[model samples]
Target: MYSRLSLSWITSSWAIGLLLVFPVIAIIYQGLQPAGDLFQHLMDTVMWDYIRNTVLLILGVGVLSFAMAIPAAWFMAMCDIPGRKYLQWALMLPLAMPAYIVAGIYTELLDFAGPVQSVLRDLLGWQTARDYWFPNIRSLGGAIVIIASVLFPYLYLLARTSFLEQSVTLMQSAQLLGKTPLQAFWRISLPLARPAIAVGLSLIAMETLADFATVNFFAVNTLTRAVFDTWQGYGSLHAAAKISTLMLVVVVLLLALERFSRRKQKVFQKNMGQESARLLQMKPWQQWLAALFCWSLVVLGFLFPFSMLIYFAAQYFTDSWTTEFIEFSLNTFFIAGVVAVLACLIAILVGLFRRLHVQRGSDIPARLSSMGYAVPGTVLAIGILIPFGWLDHSLNDLIEHFGGKGPGLLFSGTMLALIAGYLVRFTAIAVGAVESSINKIPPSLDMVSRTLGHSPVKMVRKVHIPLISKGCFTAILLVFIESMKELPAALILRPFNFETLATYVYQFVSDEMIEQGALAAIVIILVGLVPLIILSRSIEQH
Candidate 1:
């Protein structure tokens, strides 16, 4: 009985379950009203276009992500490549470059008056737009490229790990049987890694669906954008909820697909001492080709935008990057830092409890917490607003009744609410990171600790925590970067006049202030690059 109710595990799981489940309940209850009418609206007005655009983006992102991620993962995991360590981090750097920020910078860069067009015009000496046919930024294909550039790392990181953990013997035996390396990879390695790949694909699909900032920035009509138009423009939370419900259904299908794919299929083989084999040497041309591929991804995804930002910053280095920009940068860092630490701690508690409590219902909290990830940032912000508004109203009323000011603390339109939203949305990422890390520790270690009369806390501290220290740090870093790049939640929930780097850039870009926006946008990317590069290199070493 004592073992069954280990305080650390049970308490953590229960709290986590509540946190995860509450918003889902709110979303469903809110969405259920006016269902029939909402469905018709969803069916009628441009909804199909939104759905089609969203679906196409997902499909395109999926194909493109896998195409880039699989080969990169394979190269890092299996082949001898130049700057393998550098490549690992370089690939992950785009995570710091938010899709929307990328959208803003790319829009400026590709605009008729932007540098690309200017350079083209200079080379050809043709002034007018008709003289040279540069593609427009505000189009579907452009949206796909912008989003996929930043999002492929999601697939790359997961698939690389999957590739690295494949038993060398299987690949070697296949090659020994006269199969080429490519044939062996497809037959032996690819199938084995399918589960991880599926998980990655599901995440990418769901993220593509949940995206609001990128689609809106690029002027593509997606479901998330539809939700915003319905709620804000139409002043209809009911309509927004309906759209959210449909989106939830889509997310559920993705979750089901991932679960179905993973069923009875363990990606990680259990045997110890199963290390990855040596990388094969490539011909001179092959080496150059591989290097070119990696470089192209890094350039399109990270370097180009960064270079543009640097140019802007240099022009403003002694000019407009003032005390105000510095303050905004500090505030952004502070909030991101707090959210990262808080979310990680909460995730560990939630994850540990879920691990220890093996009841049939234990999976509920994990599912619920992860639902935040499925929520578009705009919808999640709106969901948070509903409860926050009620809380604020109730508190204000209570204060007036007592002839005094009530504590306007909970949702005071302050940074606090923004941080809470971040915790709710990103806690899943933290939980996932911590859970996967903890899962890697041998169960025998815990058993041994228990047998030695160590308490549960002691066991975790001495055995588990030590083992997963690097993972804990990684989780913290990942959350920090995520929060840094997060847009809609911060924009909607932040107090009047409050700003993060993302919001600052968005504001300028929305008003067509391209030059200053590019400057601030670059700052956000550089901030993301520092940690992303470090984490990527760390993973490669592992």
Candidate 2:
């Protein structure tokens, strides 16, 4: 009887185990190859500086993303600044803008032949770029700003949820004890909210580490880019896998830190809680200042890049918006739909199974499933490719021995492999969203179901799942958004003659054809905005 419920549990557990083990298996396969010479080559080159720069960039972006998100969360969640509700949702709008699109816009803005420099040349009589003081956008610092801008929403969403869920009584007690608002926030709020903040920061760090498109675009040699460089740049999969292994080690360390921090904090929200934390009135000047601060982040993150894309897209429409763009759009939608549905189903199972077996070291499966989020998409693709390629070879041999010949299955050449890759890569995101929502359901609902002699499946179907349908939908939406923006895995794994909007954009961008790329990029961003808005609305409800 227990095994019946645990069947789903076992399936999810094995799925999680497979997800975690595949990357390790791929790295070991690469390492077992006779490429000890590449390791020496890596040691002899600027690998140390690459490591340092990557670490520094991660720290820089993590700190900046937090610096931007926390205050905004505090103000929007706790303060009574004008348009607070609007600002709350608006803060999340930047998630719609992909990092590479942000990089492209900044690159154009800072280029000598671009608009800003051109304006300076025309208006201020500047001759050469040497005479100007504008910052270079194609550097490490630029990558930090670009990634941080789009990434802060992760922290913002998590931190704001923590802030919203704080018991009002504790805050009132802090106020009664003669603590000022800021003091109350610092002492009572931030510490209690540390779990959520830790999770958010860990996510940001993981993203900063796993990111490939933006880092590659900016020419920053992070481990992700190093994976590509070693594989494509040097034609050595062994060297690439070594770098990927190193990245996994760093990510595991960070995940451990997040779990430790989360476990240390006591969750104090009582069932019959106090009033919602009261909002304080700000002066007119303060309101405007707050609005300006929030607006500046949105502009830097979303508006500026979006506007640039609109401009370039207009040009592309005039020049080359054709049947190719339409076909790519359809392909993008089809792939995203497949990834979202599959990921959401898997995540729901994982979330439900974990909830049912709450005391059974749920962390094991949870961490393994989430580990895919930490793995770079490109690395995960390679991992999937290795195992699938081997499976195909083995299966084909067996088929030929028994019957006639079997069609070259698995990764030989098929969309199924691509979908599998997407599922493995993005199942973490769906699990996170569904798990978070499931965590909010009271334990009594399931207990009530059991008390009435309901089956475990019925208990979940009737009691637990209905409570979190919105969250499931949001998970699907979020996965859809991510699938649309996914570049590396889709680029590497797509069958011959296949094209996605992302791939179309990449082709144009690779050749410096920014105008056409901008058209496709804009479409991707617009598709992403629907989920971003949905996520924002969900946060507000909390």
Q: Which residue ranges in model 2 land beyond 4 Å of their true spot?
A: 1-21, 28-35, 165-188, 261-263, 267-277, 318-320, 345-370, 392-413, 432-475
Q: Candidate 2 has what TM-score? A: 0.84
**In model 2, what lDDT does residue 489 have?**
79
TM-scores, in order shown? 0.84, 0.84
| 256-292: candidate 1 lDDT, tens digit per residue | 9899987988555632223334576777787778877
What is the model-wide C-alpha lDDT for candidate 2?
0.79
lDDT comparing candidate 1 with the true structure: 0.77
| Candidate-wise lDDT, in order | 0.77, 0.79
Q: Show the colliding residue pairs in model 2.
A: none
Query: What is the C-alpha lDDT profile of model 2 across 437-533, one tens digit per residue?
Result: 9889987877777779888878877877788898889889888888888888787678889998887887766556777788888888898889776
Candidate 1 Cα outliers beyond 4 Å, as residue runs? 4-16, 35-43, 81-85, 119-127, 130-132, 169-178, 262-277, 348-370, 394-412, 432-477, 530-534
